[model samples]
Target: MNGNIRKNIRIGATVDVVLKKDQPTGRLTRGQVARILTGSATHPHGIKVQLQSGQVGRVKVIVEEAPSE
Candidate 1:
């Protein structure tokens, strides 16, 4: 699923995102979500989040959902 909607994303979910610097190229970085930065329910550009690797960006794709407990 797309990552534009905040509800679709979860902490620990793997996703592809476009960093601020990479927006021009639409480059996507894959990582697990560490924290969600966007407070709104949705964003046209995508939800902002911090990755486990310390990278911050707008989510472009939902790679894998967080495992259920």
Candidate 2:
């Protein structure tokens, strides 16, 4: 990712968010990014994610594409 600890990440920028462990087919229990660990270490990865909740974990996923409006 391109953000440090305690910073609101931008779209396309990867983030290390804290995920839970009780996710559904199309739902999640997302949380704050405890700390960025690995992956790009500069940019986001995935397009759409379905991370679990409650459990603190790292996910190298992109927030969203930059708005062109």
Can you write out model 2's per-residue Cα lDDT over 1-69, one digit (the tens) per residue?
323322334333334443334323323333443333443433342222223333444343334423435
Candidate 1, residues 1-69, lDDT tens digits: the string is 989999999999999999999999999999999999999999999999999999999999999999998
Instruction: Assess each prediction's global lDDT (C-alpha) against the native.
Output: 0.97, 0.35
Q: How far is candidate 1 from the true structure (C-alpha RMSD, Å)?
A: 0.5
lDDT of 1 at 16: 98
Specify the highest-TM-score model's number. 1
Give the TM-score (vs. native) of candidate 2: 0.27
The regions of model 2 sitting more than 4 angstroms off are: 1-24, 41-54, 57-69
TM-score for candidate 1, residues paired by index: 0.98
lDDT of 1 at 1: 96
Off by over 4 Å in 1: none
- lDDT at position 68, candidate 2: 38
Report clash pairs, candidate 1: none
